[model samples]
Target: MQINGSVALVSGANRGIGRSFVEALLARGAAKVYAGARQPERLADLVDAGKGRLVPLKLDITQPADIAAAAGRCRDVTLLVNNAGINLQAGLIAAHDLAAARAEMETNYFGPLAMCRAFAPILQGNGGGAVINMLSILARVNLPMYGSLSASKAAALSLTQGVRAELATHGTLVVAVMPGAVDTEMERNFPPPKLAPAEAARAALDAVEQGAEEVYPGDMASGMSQGLAADAKAVEKDLAKYLPA
Candidate 1:
């Protein structure tokens, strides 16, 4: 889990927290980083700035073929950051977009799971490399306004735990990073107390280095996690205020 000299691969590295992770990894002296994005052209500037240390990878995490291709090509990777995800503002009830909800589950939960499955052996081969999953506070408690997205993240949390248990034998460190309303395009519509993408990325990389299995990056996520641990029902009731419009 040392960042320096470690080869890393990050999904959705074109923008948002994913892009921040690429920058942080480079700043921390990672030997090389494979920046994965749906459109590799979007990463042209990063590739230029990388000065050969950054390699742009064509990847759409939701596609099994893309996952396979990434695994096949990035064999030297020692760290996998599952940062690709989406939230279409769907809910479980009351005029929510079922299609959008399904998309959330596909991208948020299944994509990461597939990436982990595909790369587990590669990580083991690379001497027990680590995996960092970008989760959210919503993974712990449902926000009725985006209940579908919450459910998807909850599933991802479970997936992270299960992967952690299964990969324990190889010593792969599976880290789950939960942050609230990261200041990225993904959360542009959210309220205050949002964490800067760089800060969140730094926290996640810190967790990877410290061997922390779970990290809550900001005050909002930290408070929500504490509230869930203290009183699950109360947290649910509080989040219910944001029910779907």
Candidate 2:
């Protein structure tokens, strides 16, 4: 959909990929952007850039009240970007911390699920719009460090597909964007070569415009996907080499 004059709401907009999406949406001429974060004041830069077009909303996806409040506050939004997430300190099923695994699900999976549920009617009421859920390459391939994240993303990916099908009748577009390592604070501790946030944001926007159901934003993600598709078990085996014994 044409972003110009559209209103968007992006969760986790205070920093990282979420911040990039907020900036990119505004650059594309969104009439307004509700920048949602646990601490709304953290979005001061975005507020400044929007020059009154950016409205900060307090959102903690784990809380139903916050979800409802955000829905009420950004009722006119035509685009919803589910960009908030958390990476739990857990490993594979064998070495997993059940609590941490559940935390990942609460934030990475259920968070977006709740957001989509809350926003669907809002978008439909606004004449139908789009929902973008940020995913990761880990969604398809489970690694030790990314075990919880992988499972959560996998669930979110399924939700993305289901929501896409269900929302289509209402003219709402639901997309899942699975990008590889991105140069962001989230990856500060575990550095990996990655595409710049700006580049990933650009590709994401383009994917939405082109009606892509799933977007792999960077070359690294794209390449890995191709390899995995060709040999899933083999890829998993190779990935094991990088994990601790």
Candidate 3:
């Protein structure tokens, strides 16, 4: 699960934590990084800087065709970072329609699940590498404001565990990274004390190298997880008050 000399593929590499993952992988001396994004041109700078080590691939995790294509193209991948996700900011009860909630599940939950399904064999063939799923602290405790997103992440967390068990025979390491309130455009209007994407990305990679099954990347995430472990109801009640911005 080491980063150095690994052939990695990171979905949603255009920006946010995904972009940070790509940068960190390069800095760690990865042999090659296939940056997956909806628009490949957005990764031109990274490709140039990679000097042939970074391969940009068009990928939309919600689309089966895109996942199939990426799996075919990045067959040598030893590490898969499922960083592609969407937050509709929809509430289970307050939202006008179910469309946004459905979209959230498609991207945040089903997307990573599909990637794992497609890449498991590739990783098995390449020596059972690793899969890192970018989750959230909200996954452990449902925040009423973004209930749909939280629920999707929660489902993803469950999927991560199942995948880990199934991939154990192949030696693929599955790491669920739950970071609280990352300082990204998606959380621009969110409360302060957010962890920077780069910091979160680094923490996640470190956990992978250390062979941790689950990682709470920042102080907030770690603290919140601890709280949930102690009193799940208290944490749920506390998060129930915050409304979407």
Off by over 4 Å in 2: 93-96
Residue 47 error for model 1, in Å?
Answer: 0.6
- Candidate 2 lDDT, tens digit per residue, 1-245? 87888898989999988899889998999999999999998988789998888999999999999999888777799989999998754676655347878899999999999999999999999988889899988888876667777889999999999999999999998878888888888877666687788777777777778778788888878987998889989878876665523
Error of 3 at 127 (Å): 0.7
Q: Model 1 residue 10 lDDT?
A: 97
Q: Is candidate 2 or candidate 3 better by lDDT?
A: 3
Relative to the true structure, how large is the alpha-carbon lDDT of every model?
0.93, 0.86, 0.93
State, as a TM-score between 0 and 1, how close model 2 is to the true structure: 0.95
TM-score per candidate: 0.98, 0.95, 0.98
lDDT of 3 at 220: 93
Q: Is candidate 1 or candidate 2 better by TM-score?
A: 1
- Using TM-score as the measure, name the better of candidate 2 and candidate 3: 3
Steric clash pairs (candidate 3): none
